[model samples]
Target chain A: MQRLLYSLSGASGQHYSPHVWKIMMSLKHKGLDFELKPVSFGDISKIEDGSFTSVPVLNDQGTLLGDSFEIAEYLEETYQDAPSLFDGPGGLQLSHFVESYCKTVLHPTLAVIAVMDMYNIMSDADRAYFRPAREKRFGKSLEDVYAGRDAELSTLPEKLNPVRDLLTNQDWFGGEKAMHADYVLFGTLQWCKVCCPDPILAPSDPVNLWFERMLDLHDYMGRKAVSEAVAA
Target chain B: MQRLLYSLSGASGQHYSPHVWKIMMSLKHKGLDFELKPVSFGDISKIEDGSFTSVPVLNDQGTLLGDSFEIAEYLEETYQDAPSLFDGPGGLQLSHFVESYCKTVLHPTLAVIAVMDMYNIMSDADRAYFRPAREKRFGKSLEDVYAGRDAELSTLPEKLNPVRDLLTNQDWFGGEKAMHADYVLFGTLQWCKVCCPDPILAPSDPVNLWFERMLDLHDYMGRKAVSEAVAA
Candidate 1:
């Protein structure tokens, strides 16, 4: 039996990784045996520097696995008894939508807007310094950060409808059982929730309802290796 | 005999994705049959709002796959006869590095900085006004981007030294023989070359040499994909 370690970090509100939470639930739900360790963000001093290794890393014995997508894919596939992230055509299709949501929709629009300085967390001096400085570079204003997001939200219906349709058609995004698509959506939506105000993009009641059901499994995480505090 | 359809954007210089290139090469090296299609960047709008879905997406019949990481991982497992990206422990280690390189080093540093304006062919205003504007957001001026990157470049030896040191121990990044690690490095570094003038953090002669070797792999990219028209 390979002992697994999940290294992750979330402190204050700076951490936007819902991946840790989802994985915790998945592993527990599957009853897969593994260790979990929450790593602090930016502990490069712990890095070998030769490997330039960073965390949200998974270590099995000495071998390392990281990258949320890769990690999720590997875990689901390697564990025969576990739920899968990608099952068939519908699963594959929803994955395409979620990928865009993370990078195109979430990273730029949500992540840029909801940082500490971007919010009221930072002191005025700090805001004037790093916030204004980075803002000019990405080519937007403090206002423009969320300005056209309303417009961008309008476009999600066509892009996300496929997945939205999946919600009602199947118990999960993959159209059979809840699998990796649920986790990916859960993670991205979590990140979006932290980084940007929830956009009333589409009538996402089913998506919201699915989240309520997901919590039933989160208790399974408490019975697993990553039961520390949970993402509050 | 699953017919893999690879749709690539017509342009080559900046939008070049190393992940796509890696999968393409893996399929070729294995003599696995796949159909190659050159997709225009955004000439025809996709069902999704994103252009990436319109680019280098793979279809097994009508089944869709998106995102370089996902697509490459999909290909790696779906076709066992195709060159494997993840073989075992050592291969997984390299895959993590490739994933990290994409997120930590490549996306924020290289893609955001060098390839920003290249994403959309610059109008005069984009060239003059937006070019410099985007560069500064990286917390470095163009000159600073160069200088700041030297520190990051030195770190690569650490992240990669495990493999480079392995060359003395065995063959490619994975060890005994060339595995997906070689292709991952190739794709990422190729993305660096096309997107950024600098390779391996600076004018790296070693990287240049390796690049030449990778290009020689006949099916590395369909020769016609990067013809005079797309090469522009």
Candidate 2:
């Protein structure tokens, strides 16, 4: 009857999958105790009878669930007494828009910006699987993608224009407090922070300041991660 | 004690300001009665003792307010018994993100796409005021800006990637029904519809379908507006 989260781990057991971090923060937000079972990219298929293809697959007691948003909803529904991940259905619905923003606006530049670091931190087997998979996805070799990293990095601030504009008036995406929307964005940025040696956001930028506050949330849950930002 | 919304009017008495449309939808959403006072770009300064410089200035029985979001908040607070614009604070807060998305992602492309049509639809006084003002903002003559419009139009579907992704799962941004977030996006597209002969979204696109539904909302309030889309 143990709650277990199957997370994609890198070299030295670093958990850096943005989607996995989303569930990681959600679990902690719900005040739920769980075991982190680290699986490499090659090892992903070996978990749970090879039923799930991705990481952040949560095995809650006997039930198994994948997909971060679905897991967030499941957690909210199951752990009714816990701090609500979404304050209400309104927050819950709009949280999807936040997800959409991250995917459409942030993902392309970040994937390019962090791909090299992400590859460098992976175990040999994971690296073997990751490189070809990602190259095929981008239709370019990993090195070619990494060559454009500086150009991609230059666009990061403009990609984050919406978030920077939002932060000027509110402290969090959740209005007064950090909610699922905040975590969705945090996980996106945290992925880059954990992998890339160069910081994605400028220190003085309001979005970065909000990320600093997010890192301090839940007893510095994000800060505790093995990030290149921390190493630098 | 009539509620009057001062809006920017076009050549044929058309209210085409996106910000003004936001207030228009919001007023109807709250089931409140308000008169639409048409003011051209030149007439904006004459409204409310020349205090505000924007359209969508609401004189709620003599309590003057500018800014669409602030006006929405005021309406939500004053007419508590009416249907909620935001279901709660969560929606209210996330609605800002929608506004930011519309501003950052949609506005740039749309302003360029509709510049010529907008110019054509304006009265002589408005055209006189609008041309130099918009040229100053864009740093190009109206003809030069319009020359690159098709290029701007080409980027629109990609710009709307987030909205298209959101529409796949939910019928409205508000989940079950239309909310302020929907109105925010609706106002953006509705502005283009009222001016531009070239429809921005593809006819079969899911985003366009949702907009069709938005037009049918509140007893066809949006469709009742004078639009090039309807004219075409």
Candidate 3:
């Protein structure tokens, strides 16, 4: 029997990145036999110090794999018989674009949003809890970051103009097909909306419709409809 | 006839980011019937603010393949018998580590070296010519950067520790065969040596030996012998 396991966050499952939940929920809906193991990116001093002996690794019959992109690749390769999110060179191209969008553009933008959202939603005591972890990673004062929020937020709209342009009247970034890239982008966007609800992306674009459609995917709403409803 | 076009800048070539060249040389050696065309990364305006249309796209039979890793993957998939630097899952793992090292550590390190080599090696007027682009890409403040060079340099040791620990005094980064990862890392190392000679890595430990073996490779040395004889 084929099995899969994901390292997830236990305490901050409230602030869990949508990408993680997407993978977990996808497997669950498939009714596949799998296990979920919580892995902490929040305070991964062990990873930082190079004791990455066990972390977010996907195991295929006990063979461990690392790197989210690599794990995705391995899953695709190993489960060749499984329902595919990839189509061909075209699909690969689309997936590659989504990865780039997430890695280079959206991910960083979402990170900035995370800081803003934490401050906005969290209590003084609650903010204190997250601030230290963030400080370790960014080495910046949250007050200063918060002070410059409008300026930081302003630049994103222009940065997002290109993404918005791509989304203009399109059902998905990868065109008509709901490929892996769409799901990947959706995961990041979902996170961004929670972590940084910018009105710029809220206006009518075909992408918003696509976002709504993904919520209707099997187990997607079941797993997190309550959470997403709150965030939305 | 199958064709591929590489977008390039003759001067940005000086940064000697070997990931660009490794792909170039790989294609050159792969003996695939193809053509190379140079394009600009700065010409995002031409792309009209689209998604992830970054450097080094391979145009094969009118299909656009961007992202060097994906390009390599596409070629490997499309051409079964092309001379492959990567072979299997271990090959994938090694290539990933090399990519991670390059982006996270080596390329940034080498960029510093490239500037210095250009500074030390370039004539006063030639320095004037290349300064703006370097300044634009890296930053205008060389003295500030050079001040923290030792600190930044320390990260290289820490970063390479994984490869070093896993290698355990081996012939290659991925066991016996010189795989894609070795080539990728070697390309960066080679670029750094040419662009900036460093005591840390120049007369260093495993780096020195690894350098020798990489240069000893027929394809690698062939390029070296050409570059050495040519006046850059």
Candidate 4:
């Protein structure tokens, strides 16, 4: 069966959507060969017969799947004999906890820190749609919303204290192996890495070290991905 | 073989130490029969031997274990035939993540919100030790530390947003069944319930609902425990 993953991309072909990256890593972990189809914001709704409105809409043997978590669940159940994304019973809940942590704690912080950098890297059409939507959400212009970027960026390390402490004791969030939980966090960090030049984690920090190790996984797929910030 | 768990308690015999509660819940989950020995802050160092200086020193068949996480590991490994505290592979890491969350996020916030209540509930000896130690940690008097508690308490719901979101779709942090991850968070909330008059969670919140369900677990052990704040 042919598997194709539709991922959100930048003008320079940088795959930066955290949700899309999550499914990419999950598919790789399950040893599934998949092709990536880059999509712009304007192209999302038109994919898979206008049924979906998001990046990471996976087409597996002509069956369309949306939402990273739902796609992960589908992959886990369908490819049951393949290496498990969730190591065991409690893993599904923990992976969801990691997802929530990324959404509630990390995403907003990253959005503020990388607002201008993200704008600089997007296609003109995406930029047109991004500004008004984000301004409406923040109730402020992009420039005004990102004015407190330094203070927001300083809070990132403190917010990541739990993850740092976890990495201090274990090699991965999934204990010995990197599972969906690890990928969930990796995707968030990867989003920042792909779009922003300022480093989210220090080189000496355990989380940064873990990120480097994660980049080496699956034949250095993350390391080889184009960083729009670096490219520009 | 007899099993004994030394737990930190207040003057009115409320088991309020979050660390101790974690072991209590773990022991129950593993189906191990144990006795709870209530101790004050001053009594911690003198529990099993002078080697340890903390509560939750588990004495099992002559083997002494300190640290809640270590005690849990010992229980899980030693009682391999019994039920597991960590349901599977990733569970250990996720359980640790929950522990780190309680330590980094919840503990400090709870300490400030319940400072006065905790001080009031402590034994005279523990009060002398707790006040100076805590005051030094905050670099202020207990009164000053607690003065900003209303603001600090307000941030707790936001801090607990991840857990609340996790519980929205699952019954527990441990997925279908309550495991160590559930116990890890339960211990933190249980500490506040035991020591403070003000409820940390609103009655209608998912976290509050989950707490009520947690209290009913292990044959109502948490619900049956005395609340020092309520007693006074």
Candidate No. with top DockQ: 2
- Calculate DockQ per candidate and list them: 0.02, 0.72, 0.03, 0.70
For model 1, how big is the CA root-mean-square deviation?
14.0
Classify candidate 3 by CAPRI docking class: incorrect
Expressed as tens digits, the lDDT of each residue in A28-118 for candidate 4 is 9999989999888899889978989887899999988999999988999899999988867667767888888888889989999888888
* TM-score (chain B) of candidate 4: 0.95
- Which is the better candidate, 1 or 4, if ranked by DockQ? 4
Better of 1 and 3 by TM-score: 3
Write down the TM-score of every candidate: 0.40, 0.94, 0.44, 0.94
DockQ winner between candidates 3 and 4: 4
TM-score of the second chain for every model:
0.62, 0.96, 0.69, 0.95
- Fraction of true inter-chain Cα contacts (below 8 Å) kept per model? 0.00, 0.62, 0.00, 0.65
Per-residue accuracy of model 1 over A1-232 as CA lDDT, tens digit each:
4655544333432333566555654565466667655444334225322242544555545656666656666666677565445553223322433443445434454444444323443334434554666577668776676566566555544434434444544565433456665666666555444434344334456655665565456454322222222333
Q: State which candidate, 1 or 3, has the greater lDDT.
A: 3
Q: If ranked by DockQ, best first, what sequence of candidates would result?
A: 2, 4, 3, 1
User: How large is the C-alpha RMSD of every model relative to the true structure?
Assistant: 14.0, 2.2, 10.5, 2.0
Clash pairs, candidate 3, are A8-A38, A8-A39, B7-B39, B8-B39
What's the lDDT of the predicted structure labeled candidate 2?
0.88
Model 2 chain A scores worst on lDDT over the 10 consecutive residues at A223-232
Candidate 1 ranges beyond 4 A from true positions: A1-10, A13-15, A18-22, A33-41, A44-55, A83-102, A112-137, A141-158, A194-204, A220-232, B1-232
Model 1 clash count equals 8
Superposed by TM-score, candidate 2 places the C-alpha of residue B223 at a distance from the truth, in angstroms, of 1.6
